[model samples]
Target: MAAPLSLRAPAATPRLPRLAGTIRQPLLGAVAVALFLLSWWGATASGMVARLFLPSPVEVAQATWRLLGSGQLVAAILASSARVFAGFAIAALIAVPLGIAMAVCGPVRAVLTPFISLLRPLPSITWIPLTILWLGIGETQKVAIVILGCWIYILLATHEATRRVDPLLVRAARNLGAGDLTVMREVILPAALPGILAGLKVTLAIAWSCVLSAEMVAAHNGLGAMIWEGKDWGDMTQVLVGMVAISLTVLLADLVATRLERALLPWERHRRH
Candidate 1:
């Protein structure tokens, strides 16, 4: 007989490096962004771009730094943020309950569905003329703009998520003696939390966009107004600085939303539960 077969199975490839890569990639990306900004600054400082239109990175940084050092940045941030929050809060307040009620009640759903269908596709900007007519160029107008911008998205998200709550879960809740309020609170909300929260994230971002639209019309004090003023004055550095500030604010808002989701979805966090 030939020598006994001595072949062995191939060893498994290591997964640690792949796992590490997942974490390393974002870190590398962040580092790359910082490096890019640094290089951009160097180029600008060296007069790579015309100062009028494309201000040197250093000039933009200086403008931003000065704004930050003063309270102007803070005031603009607060004003824009307040508009966003007020509008978003109003939409959420109305949408969530309305969505749940409509999903659970056919007659109510029939009554409202037509209106939501008609209104949702109309751009928020389209409402600006009507809103200004109704609310005028005051805080009311700004809030209305934000509201019009965000309301449809919030309503749709809430309605769809509510409607799509798993039938099995609803049945299970009924079988277990859960009532409407309890079922909604315990089963439906939890089940739809992820989707609803996801919608909030989207709406919040849109709220940011809407706030800018609201601010640009005639607001004396907002980041949006700041940008417009900067442009009119040919202060490209300030304009770019405003853009950067908005971007940073959006990123920070995303971070807060993520943390809020993680905190609220305890069952999601603990999969075993």
Candidate 2:
């Protein structure tokens, strides 16, 4: 009987050699960074770029080390991280549900679409003036700024993601006797989640920018304050150090987010593999 045609699903094809593939990205990133540092050193060394205007990478690294030793860097990182977490957490809580509502309910989408369209184009920095006026430059103002900067985009992205969930899946779930809530909870959410997570990663980056703008205007201890202080003093090394610190912090956040996405969507990972 031809060996009872295989009943199991076929195994997924393996990707390129695992060890090599795993190391390749970081290795290339390291090489690219090395080349950038070399070019930076060359520019400063040859006097093509004045040190006063753009300090050497070595000088910035030394300044970073000194800040690290003095505990200033740690303090700034904590402060900035807290503000970002608070703001982003709030935004996500607000946006995700509302976004799903907008996606599923025509009336809700109609009501919010106009507002989102009107506000989304305004940059994070513009909100600084109004936020300061209302919230008075405290931590509240900073967190609010981050919230405004992030929530709208996240809501819109979530709406789009949720709307993209296959209509057939919804129909199937409903036919199987799933109610609206159950259909949404089990079918829509799982399908929409991958896109929502991707959007959150981007929105988190925007949150950082918003916090920086907020801190620059009226804060004392965040990375934005550090940058503004260095600028005022014309300490290129300090300025570069603050910039590098922000970049590194964002990079770390992005890495964490990428891992989280892989964890939450294992099927996506397997498909990619």
The positional error of residue 178 in candidate 2, measured at the CA in angstroms, is 1.2
Q: Per-prediction count of colliding residue pairs?
A: 0, 0
lDDT of 2 by residue, 1-273 (tens): 567788899998776688787999899999999999999999999999999999999898899999999999889989999999999999999999999999999999899989988998998899999888888988999999999999998998899999999999999999999999899889999999998998999999999999999999899999999999999999989888989889999999999999989988988986776
Q: Candidate 1, after superposition: displacement of residue 49 in Å? A: 5.1
Q: Name the TM-score of candidate 1.
A: 0.85
Note the Cα lDDT for every prediction shown: 0.85, 0.93
lDDT score of model 2? Answer: 0.93
Q: Point out the worst 10-residue segment of candidate 1 by lDDT.
A: 264-273
Candidate 1 overall lDDT versus native: 0.85
| TM-score of every candidate relative to the true structure | 0.85, 0.92
Clashing pairs in 2: none
